[model samples]
Each structure stands twice: as C-alpha cells, then as structure tokens.
Target: MSGTVLVTSRSFGSGGLDLERRISDAGFHVVRAGAAHELDELGPVLGDAVGWIAGTGPVTERHLSLAPHLRVVARYGVGYDKVDVDAAARRGIVVTNTPGANTSAVAEHTVALLLAALRGIPAADRRVRRGDWSAWYTREVSALTVGVVGLGRIGRSVIDRLAGFGPRVLGADPWVPADDPLFDRLERSDADAFATECDVVTLHAPGGQTVVDERWLAASDRPVLLVNTARADLIDEAAVAAALRRGRVLAYAADTLATENHGEGASPLLADDLADRVIVTPHLAAQTREGVDGMGGMATENLLAVLSGEPPVNPVPVP
Candidate 1:
C-alpha cells in the first residue's frame, strides 16, 4: 500500500494540476493522466499503484482487474456513478468520494440558477448587451412558490438559503421523516404533484433515468421554472426539450447535462436552442476555489486512510 498512486483525472484547468503537485509533495508518486480513454495504456502504468485519485472515468471490472496492487480509489467529487464500486469492493479496494465538501457551493449555485430564471437575469443581461435596456420590470420573489426535490445535504442547504427569500419552500423527499422540522410544510408526494404545485422547481435528485419524464412535465399546472444543479439524468432531456417547446416550462437552468462528454456532433441538452430563457452551465456547480481545495484534500485523506487499512470517510457501496 506504499507504492505510487495513479491519478486518472478528467480535463481540469491548470489549477487541478497544481493540486496534483501538492499531493505529490505529500510523499506519494503521482502518475497523472488526462483521461481513461486508453485503458490498455493505463493498465501497465497503474499496475503497481496502491491508490488512485479518480475523476469521471469508466473504471470498470476489467480496469480493476488490471491493478492488483490497488487498495483505494478516491473520487474527486460526490458522484461516483462513473466508477464501478462493486468491482472495487470485490477486489477489497475501497472507493471513496468527497460528499459534503461541495454542498455549500452547489447550494449557492442552485439559488443563482433559480433567481436567474425567476427574475429574468439572463434575458435582461442579454437585452442590455444588445442595447435593448428598458426600465426594470416589477418582480416578486415572495409571490413564487419554490419546490425542492431530494432534501439531502445540498437540498437542506438550499432550503436554509431560501428561507430569507420570502418564498414558501416545499420539499419532496420520501426518506425524510414526517415529523422532521425540515418537513414542516413539505409533502411526501410524487414528482408530478410537486411539479404541479410549484412555480419554481429546483432539482437535487441523484443521476439516473426518467426522474423527470414527459408525464411529470405534462402534469404541470403552470409554466414552471426548472433549475437542476444536480445530476443531468434526474430529468429526461427529450421531455424537457418538449416541455420548453410547448411553454410547459417557462425557463430552465442546469449545471450538468445528460451527456457531459458529448463527442463530435453529439446533441447536448439545450445546445441546439440558444434561447436567452435557458441557462446551461458546463458542469461547474462545485468548481469553486474552496470546493476544489476541499474536494482534493478530502479525497487525498480518504485515499491515505484506505491505504492505511482504515475506513473511508465517504465509502460508496460495492456489491
């Protein structure tokens, strides 16, 4: 467990490389690679590695089998969906992720998206840039009802931040207890019901398929403003596009997309339609300076702990 560490990272700005240097200074040989596109190339390089600081790479069972000396795989961010946790667990290699490190940043970004959508910030900015500045229009934040999906750490932070906005915040989390103070006015209902009732709907749900489908979009009683700072798969892309076309959704803002690594000619969500009403940030909700340092520190600590035969701080379930 004292060998060199392989860092299979996605494309990060120069700042990420600086962080890797810091890790190297901490007495671990860091073998840095851009991406995991060449698993064949990675196999030999990572053969003797004891720890891995991973990014959004496809670390499958086959990839795990290549590194018999690997004891830990520490993901950069909260989502470890791209990594094969079960495979790592089977090989007794602990998989860890930085969970709460980026919660505040994400929560703030979620609020930004919500405010941008509700107050027409993007539209107004575009209009002003084009010499079309008119007098400020009247808008009321208190008048809008905001609904939060998945009341986890980020969700709770969102709720806490939104408390001062004067909007009634409703939540829909099946896991939350009925008597919990967070669920004061929150309801344990379906996504459709939540969609139908709220003027602004912010998503904090995990990545998967069909969390927000055509049916949920169709069930909306009014033109809803959708903000998803969470995973892209929480909302169906095609359904959201259709919703935008028909005015079912007034506006939409997202920090993540269904396909992040969309190769040449790939259709990303809201890429074709460059409407001012929609705000799409390249998956950077948790890319703040503090977030990066915290995530890197936590991930490094987790890798160190696992390699030292201790439990990881945020262990992902394997098989």
Candidate 2:
C-alpha cells in the first residue's frame, strides 16, 4: 500500500482472478477508476497515482498536468490514438501498449461477422422471432472472393481461418513487401484492385483518418459486404451509409463503431432502418475471456516494469 497504481480498464479483472493481488504482489496499492474512457472522474484520482492502465480514453496533456506522481500510462489495447505520446515523453513519462494481445479475439469475431452477414443470420433471426416462417437467403460465404486490407497479426489470423472455408483470399497491404515470405499463401492485390475484385471486403488495416471512403468501394464489380473490427476511423461512415442505401455495399459488420457507446444513439450505420443491413457489436470482439486476461496481464506487467526502474516490455514508438 505504498505507491499507488490506478487501473482504469473496465475489464481488468474480468478474468475472475484476484487482479488486485497480482498488482499488490508487485508492491503497489491498487486504485480502481471506473474506466479510462470516463475522463471526467479521473481528475479526483490522478494526483497520487504513480501508474495507470488505460482503456479507450484520451490521456491528454491536460489530464497529465494533474498527475504529479504518474510514471507510466499503459494502454490496455493496441490502439494509441487516445493517448498523447509526445506530451507524456516531454514530461518523461513512459507510454506502453498491449499489442497482439487481442488478435485471436478480434480475428475470430471478424470471421463470425462475415458468416453472419453472408448467411443472413441476424436478419433471418429477426424474421423468425417475429413469427415469420418463410426463409430468405442472400449469398454463400464459401463462394465469395474475400479481400483483406491489412496483413498484420490480426489480419493474417483472419486469412488463416478463411482458408478452411474454401474461398480465394486476396491480401492488400502497402506496408508489407510484395515478396515477403510471411504471405506465402495470400495472393497479393492492391487496395484498388481488391475493392473491385473482392465480393466480401474485410478491413483489418491500422487506425487512421478516413482510410476507406466512398471511393474505396465505389468501383466494386459486384455488391460487397464490408467488415471492420480495427478502428472506426478506417472507414467513412457517411459514405458507407450512402453505399448501404444504394445497395452497392450490401452490409456492414463491425465490432468498433464511430462511438464505442452509442449513448447519443447509433452512429450512421446503426440506424433503425439499417439495423437489418448493419450489424454492430458493442466493441466486444476482444472482450472474450482470454483476450481480457491477456491484455490485462500485459498492461499490468508494463506498469510494474516502468515502476521497477526497468524498461517497459512494449514501449510505444515516439512520434
């Protein structure tokens, strides 16, 4: 109960083990903050916290000003868009993130969504629930040409799973070398070519602003199914909505949305009319039991490493 560590990730102890014991065993008093995303309440608890494990919230310069003892900000997941890395480094605070920790969780969910969309699972379930016995069908999953936008950990995982389903999997990634040995099986295709050639396009690309817009999917030779589990910023929602309306993009399945919690109502794709066309999860793709525990352990280990005068296992790259 000497130095304080604040755990703001909501699912930190969701594995049902003694999460507090793990940190306390390392010689720090555990302080619980609701979730890093809830920044308003963070001000009251930041003053004494020497370490913090964050969730999907912004760790801004303004917030850091209040944490006089804060030594490290450990992001609970891979995405670091929410944290201000430059400012943290300026104050000599180490920033760390748990990457590849949720790979399986997200990859499994992405495939599940692909099946749901192609098989018309959600839409059909609604029809059956409302007492309609008539069966409706759309497309078969195994027959569709699939395109994967990123060939990284989660992206590669998705392709590996797709191989058993009997569809041709095309990979589109500018970051990876064309002759990289890692992509022995995945046929290489550029994003533009993949867009028109792929019947089902799934985005596992890295996070950034407007990576996919109307232009990306507009040239499709056929109606397409769009799946996104990486980050909402990767796709232009308004354009996707327009495509859904026009039937160029048949459906959209995603774990992450424009707003993680749609308290203000659904993002553009979550509209009532589009509910049948758009399937959105509450960002739980990586909320699986295994994913939660793995990410929590990684984030905690990073925090303890920084506090113990050791370099973090996975320090975020300085921008």
lDDT of 2 at 275: 85
Score each candidate by Cα lDDT. 0.78, 0.85
Tell me, by lDDT, which candidate is best.
Answer: 2
Winner by TM-score: 2
Residue-by-residue lDDT tens digits, candidate 1, 111-166: 98888877888878888999997856635768888888888899999988988878
The TM-score between candidate 1 and the true structure equals: 0.88
How many times do residue backbones clash in model 2? 0
